[model samples]
Target: MLVDQYNPFEGKMLQILDQEGNITDEKLLPEIPDEELVRLFKIMLYTRVIDRKALMYQRQGRMLTYAPNEGQEACQIGSVYALEQRDWMAPAFRELGAWLTRGVDLKTLYLYWYGNEMGSKVSEEIRILPVSIPISSQLLHAVGLAYAAKVRGLDEVSIAYFGDGGTSEGDFHEALNLAGVYKTPTIFLCQNNQWSISVPKHFQTASETFAQKAYAYGFKGIKVDGNDIFAMYAATKEAVDRARKGEGPTLIEAYTYRLGAHTTSDDPTRYRDNTEVEAWREKDPVKRFRIYLEKRGLWDEEIEKAYVAEKEEEVEQVFADIEQNGGTAFDDVFMYQYAEMTPILKEQYAEWKAFFQERGML
Candidate 1:
């Protein structure tokens, strides 16, 4: 029959489960206990609910433009949970789930979307950077942190999260090159959701797969089923452990789909079809994980109800907190810039504060 020879690039790739909720590789599965699995599920549910609420808030003009991580919860949660508390996280926009999993306050996330810069005033104790919106710029920051850690003889690693579109940026290549040369402890986590805003992955690059690019950088590369929480956790755990052990960086390409608009300001219907969205919905990460939980007799209707109710209450409190704080204030904007504000910045701040006061808006 002259069947083609097998290649790592021409295979189904590494995975622990299928969309039908069947375990395909028992040995590669994560050793998550039942309680931990339940907690993971609850976190995903909470994120989903929060995303929905944020969408509603945007429509009601209560929040500025917001990005929704509707179907990629498992990818974010699994990857972040796999990291140690000492490890750093440098994220691009659309990493709400990762930040929340890393102990960022839900109210802070809400405040960020509400146009408050204070939302990004993460505690110095938390090893997370302010959300980078300039595409792949954070990759360099992650590499720099990794290099510094290595120079200081620190075992900590830094994980940088970006989308498929980010791979095309010059900063991405530069960061990877530096990480490779320095053998920094950095994990380049690329969430290939198949779309970068309205641009589809196929148009983003001609490469067969995003993971293959890692070969040019002389590092291990992996492509996993992003929708599978088990696969994500296992792969990330291995990468984090390797980095902590003084191994070089790894490139993890999570092949997943974005089930909603890129952001509230975007409309996917203009660039794609409903059929595609419907197809990905069938592989919903939350639903698949729920099915897996059910098969093990670990999930029930009562649990589902209770979880949803609790999530709703939590989201409600976040919204109330944001609203009561008058959303974002003008003074909050000038607090984080520098120890001493520049004269120009001080003048601008005073002008803004005066303008708000004149309108009785502050």
Candidate 2:
């Protein structure tokens, strides 16, 4: 009989703050200024407000489909805050929290949801790529950019944000392989929100844990409690530091839950039970973080009300700007694609112009 090797991959999930706003382990707490912790809490509030506004906008028919990251705010905000301004981010569609944390203007984010192509054009200096809607396609772009930085001798790392669904994509495999081979400075942040639309995580993959997938690529893969801001920040900060020191990539699987529908168009209740949603809501990132802040004397009911009102005013102003700016032009499809319009594109543009002209709408 042949002896069989018992190869079991054991990955521990890191959680600093528990469901009741208490620390699970004091030793795992990340060292950061008191003000920064407050800022993180504020960002979570901002994200939740904006996300609710998105749903309101969709209901009012002012915007198209939007993927709300209401329950996963800490996962995005904490990891993003850990990055240096010089680092690059390649985002999947539901990265509003991350973008906001990285200083992406609310107008820019709103315009993108409004279906304007110009919103995709981010400044090179901002280092945030246009949102990639094709699942894990952006991971390849992130890996390529990280490899380029290596070639150019730039000490910048790239982060790719994608959902649990993205891990099943071929692009994920290719990107991780390339990063492992070249030892590229990259971080793959997987927001394992437990659902890919109507599909539950178990249906998506048979793997025991998504983080262990990193071992096959020859790097560290950590599973962090996505609801814990401190844990998310600590994990990301450590991975970022290693990457900056040319220690290659790290895959962080943030185990979270989507407390809302997958998108504005989705009816999650048709598939998932209310009990499941309620259970996840109990593990709410914002509530737990707020509890922690309260325990530290950093927050209270009065402050919460005032801070929410202030953020609401800011959101109203963003909507006002969007209303004043108006919608995107129909010809924007052909106009933004190339620096100089190609002859073929020019002909197509003219055809559309004539079509709209004949209808007396142009």
Candidate 3:
């Protein structure tokens, strides 16, 4: 039976619980302590609260354009918490939960969406790259960092998070090929949210599954229910362990749904149906996890109230900080480049500064 179950093209997909909050497979479960499970759930709740608050802030004109990971908290937080602090993280635009789990302050995240460049200036000690907006470009950075760690004899690994659309990028193919050939300790996590902007998953690729693409690169892959926090945690832990042990890379295609618009600038309703959105709402990560917690007798009305109150307070504080530092000066754009600025950049900077000064806006 075990021999029949083994297939090289079939990734080791492990899911512990179903959407109905029923445990489907207990044997594949990891030894997660109850306390840690509760902690992870709380972080997931925090992410949801932050996402909602960020959306409100954007709508109220208090923040610049924002991307809300409304239904992807479990996918981001579970994978992030499974990693060691020394391991590097490279994330695309929608990774607030991952950044928060990596110890980035909520205030800084808010600042980033508020048009402050300092928001992306994470401390070197944190080992998280700035949010990459150019799609799958960060995968190359993750591969390089993992390669460097391997050369330095360090047990560290690098994880890059991108969406299904990113899988079609040339950079994604290049990074995966190089990592496989060199055996770099990297994790290529693709959050298959079923839609890339307005395009559906059916149009993203012709392959039956994103995990199967890893076969061409000579690496193993897995597909997991991204809404299942336990599954994501378990799968990421196994992948990270293998990478740290010098077993090369793993491609994880986290199957999930983007319940909200791509960003504040997008209107998903224009391209999708309300019935489809309602269908995905039934599989919400927060609701499913809450059901699991309740079944375990770990959740209650009073506890929910307390958690909501605390999250509201924390979000209020973040908004306050963002308001205090809302404005960005024209000079701030020229600080983070190379040792010397190009002639064109200098000319443009001078023009922008003068324009802002004349308008009394700097």
TM-score against truth, every candidate: 0.94, 0.95, 0.94
Most accurate candidate by lDDT: 2
Q: Residues 172-249, candidate 3: write the lDDT tens digits.
A: 999999999999999999999999999999999988788878879988888888988888888888889889888899
Instruction: Score each candidate by Cα lDDT.
Output: 0.87, 0.88, 0.86
Determine which window of 10 residues in candidate 2 has minimal summed lDDT.
1-10
Q: Which stretches of candidate 3 lie over 4 Å from their true place?
A: 1-13, 339-343, 354-362
Give the clashing residue pairs of candidate 1, or none. Answer: none
By TM-score, how accurate is candidate 2? Answer: 0.95
Write candidate 1's Cα lDDT for 1-362 as tens digits: 00011123665456677888999868677898999998888888888999999999899988899998998998899888899889899999888778878888887788888888888878887899999999999999999999999999998999999999999999999999999888899999999999999999989999888877877897777887899998888878888888888878988888889999999999999999999999999989999899999999999779899889988998888798788884555676787678789898899999988998999987
TM-score of candidate 3 against the unseen true structure: 0.94
**Backbone clashes in model 3:** 0
* Candidate 3 C-alpha error for residue 185, in Å: 0.3
